[model samples]
Target: MTDDNKIVIRERSTPSKLRYASQKLIEMHDQLIDRGVDKQRATLIGIALHLESMAQAAESSAGPNLTPGFVNEPGSTSELLPAEILAAIDVPPYLSTACDTALRVEPADVPDATGWARLLHARCRLNNKFTGAPCPCTCHGREA
Candidate 1:
């Protein structure tokens, strides 16, 4: 597909939505572990889900003009959802931590059962989804 065809119109995520999504992630992780699922798979799922939520929340919170490449409907930026500023402030740190954790992993070892390994993989995927960065999704950023 051409670049135009590949373009996705993303909606900004609100702070309330972010919190709701985070809660959902915590629940998802707890349930997966509780259900005797593989820790690796469960962590991957949980992290992906959390990242998805974060993305949506970001869409809501990002100003219509936050990125120059995409177009936003007129007035969308000013008419933001009425959410607490403190809640909105969480996005940067949340994304930062997720990205940092993601960057440190070995793609091959990411699917391992160690703490947050699978989560790191999932975060990398989300990073690509959001920023269109070159993510191999194989957990091998160091070698590349």
Candidate 2:
């Protein structure tokens, strides 16, 4: 596209890192086209290579050990979910006992059924139907 046709993507004043990456992609595409690559293939290859480079940059910039548990993230950026919900979905033997007992416990038994309460709260938040209204579980509005 020409300068006049170039689309301006303004999102919170375009993050510097993102703008740099986008400009690099444009440069790569132009360079490949100059070297006689077909426009479609040049654009595709440029975008793919740029994405791989960005992912590698992010991975190397991240310091320390790989994260533990389900996410295996390098940092604390992963979404935190309740252990109760995790176990409930997988039904691990150890936590299954807790789940069974917790599930049977009354919702009013907050301390005793903390795990169950967490599972219910997580369910309410993650599922769209429940997000519109106050959760009917013990842990609802408690995250604050």
Candidate 3:
């Protein structure tokens, strides 16, 4: 408790809290699956997208200090930081594929020329699929 009517923080965020949050998210995932939303890839994509958004918001609120370029010397060529530019990179190809899967579009619908990129990311071909692409159809993408 504090004079400002807010609880005073005495400890830093711990791994236990992170674990609990992860577990709760997993439980919510299970519940979603039970509700006929069984697309694991798509679910993961959605979660990743949500997390990235949250990270961007945090980075923005923390201002210039959060990026690697903020510490550049006085004579730097540009104001934009390289790290910030990298952070704005588009969603990964596999993640995009997952989004497409969740949206009920065939893999062919996404023409980003990253077919082999999925393999590099180690996100494809986990179970019973010839290519690195998993069975996106199993994840409610067709009927959603």
Ranking by TM-score: 1, 2, 3
lDDT leaderboard ranking:
1, 2, 3
Instruction: Write one digit per residue (lDDT tens) for candidate 1, span 1-144.
Output: 344633222345455555555556566666767897765555545655665655554664464534554433221333333457535554331233344565565344543434565555544433332322343334544422
Estimate, for each residue in 14-88, the C-alpha lDDT of model 2 and write its tens digit.
Answer: 344544556666676667668976545434444544454445445444544343232322222244456675555
Better TM-score candidate (1, 3): 1
Error of 2 at 25 (Å): 3.7
Listed in order, each prediction's TM-score against the native is 0.34, 0.25, 0.25
Number of the top candidate by lDDT?
Answer: 1
Cα lDDT over the full model 1: 0.47
Residue-level lDDT of model 3, residues 46-106, one tens digit each, is: 4444444344444544566434445322123334335555466652223334444434433
Kindly report which residue stretches of model 1 are placed more than 4 angstroms away from their true locations once superposed: 1-10, 39-115, 121-143
